[model samples]
Target: MTIAMPVLRPKSPHFSSGPCAKRPGWSPKKLNTSVLGRSHRSKEGKARLKLAIDLTREVLQVPADYLIGIVPASDTGAVEMAMWSMLGERGVDILAWESFGEGWANDALKQLKLDDVRVIDAPYGRLPKLKQVDGVARDVIFTWNGTTSGVRVPNADFIAADRQGVVICDATSAAFAQALDWPKLDVVTYSWQKVLGGEAAHGMLILSPRAVKRLETYKPSWPLPKIFRLTSGGKLIAGIFQGETINTPSMLAVEDYIDALEWAKGIGGLPALMKRADGNLRVLNRWVTATPWVEFLAVDKKTRSNTSVCLTISDQAVVALGAEGQAAFAKAMVARLEKEGVAFDIGHYRDAPPGLRIWCGATVQSRDLKALTPWLDWAFALTRAEFCKVAA
Candidate 1:
């Protein structure tokens, strides 16, 4: 017999965006080992690093030629390193559909101090025309997914094969949850804390030969922080990109990340993982379409994110929490779900419209999402009634 989804509870939480919800039969205690205080440069750290990289490769089916490395900082570290270390010499065409991608473009224009920067920006729900942008003259920067706005680029087919500039992607929410056209991306950065449901504080930087070559040939005039510096004497530092860190790493967090990757592999790699995310999203799609009070933040179906499914309630009472009060209500509902062991951390991004942000990542099972929908409905109803009583 088929099963029905229940409203999510925190003890059995249904949604969490990052440093996200864990998989079945996994817990922090399961990550316990005596490596807490050990130097990440030691043999113990090396083993953890190798396992982490190996597992990432296994789950992602990363190319044999491509290198996977533990870089300093989270997704921001890896991306900023690529921007600061690789740009300035070349003209850049940056794509911004949402906040994080826009943040990168801002860095390129204002911080990198680049001579020529072309920016193609769009509203939160819509995507700018990628075709309108000239790809031949300038290098391109874009996000595979817009986590905060819940929009993502549909494909990399638009990126020309022989384009002179490199393609840099911040695929934090897209990786593991979607199929990546790696050949089109010269530099890709993502954090384990997203889809892997792993702990935060670390990010991974994956490079194509083109990106690596750029790093080797170009030298920016700015000072290279140990974390952002990827080379020495104009030669790529082989160690940093090969699971070697320029600074100390948290062995405990490294192991926890490994544990999540292993779980991802156990559930069948990316194909199966994508199916899970798609399935969970279908649940949200149903809820959003049938319920008048809620709808996707993205303008169209093609750009809507399957990973971070952000929404805004349509009803006045539904929105009355004011942006701040609504955000708090969203948090309160998440807490209420948590208190009842129904769901947890379904709050929206701070700057975005009021409503809930549900993580429909692969790590979250369909059964749990099936359970979560009802909880969201239940929580919204109760919260709205209470909110209305106060207004009256």
Candidate 2:
């Protein structure tokens, strides 16, 4: 069963989930270079940073009162800052359905050592019981989109409107590509490297009034690192939210982010960004619907992520080969596609179930995904044939 190699290939084959594909028609020459080689504390430098924040607020349509800050260490840093700064005051409900969510739960239970932490979790391709989350009294932590698992919460309806405690959402993979319910989330974190595909090392942290109030009033029992500190003199540091970062940021990365933000605004803001992502997903969806040998990892269609679209081999022969064999087969297919230069970095996350994880974020063009699917089929058919021959 030899299948011909795909003749037409994706023009740009970068499908990695993080540091995703750049916005259409992006170029280094297009970035504003004046911000580079100047002190981040300089008036001009601060203004550029402020512009990024302002554009984020404008494009994301975040509520007027919620505070958006640029933080260090990408989305992980932003999440850590929120967890370390404000979780001691009340019991916490941490939900896990994927690697990143599990990491947060481990930090709360193991590192933070919170005595009253409850972990509600589900396996890969599924979501935890959102009904068990007590946002009314206990703080809740969850990832709105599980990048590794390719599962996402359908909506924020489960969160109570009158929640007394805060809800922290790690939305690194959701922002721009998906609509975020700002009122339901008290703390939201994302990185430049995700949906908009800007350079890495910087994170965006959005705090609700409730989260700011917690920061101002509640002090954690553990010692706070200088980088993690978000308060001073029992008052929220307003400068942090206004673009004065906690630490020195990469000015070049800042410019790249601003460039992406500008590109986002030029293309009709949030709605257009989400529509692009939806279009990319539809490309994959139609292929998956027609192709019988592959299936989406996300069990439920409603929970499937349009950003990090994960897939698994569904042929009974491949499934019967056991986990290790499936992993090898999938890896071979990924390698084939990469070698052919039709796709790259489509392999599943290391800890996730062995499969393929193709990034279908807003930055990725739908045409590229359409071209890549035929390559996917070619790679799979050829790899399966090799495996069968080896078995024979």
Among these predictions, the greatest TM-score belongs to: 2
Can you write out model 2's per-residue Cα lDDT over 98-167, one digit (the tens) per residue? 9999999999989999999999999999998888888788899999999999999999987888998999
Query: After superposing candidate 1, which stretches have Cα over 4 Å from the reference?
Result: 1-11, 32-36, 316-339, 389-392
Against the true structure, whose lDDT is highest?
A: 2
RMSD of 1: 3.8
TM per model?
0.91, 0.98
Q: What does candidate 1 score on TM? A: 0.91
Off by over 4 Å in 2: 390-392
RMSD of each: 3.8, 1.2
Local distance difference test values of all predictions, in order: 0.81, 0.92
Error of 1 at 146 (Å): 0.7
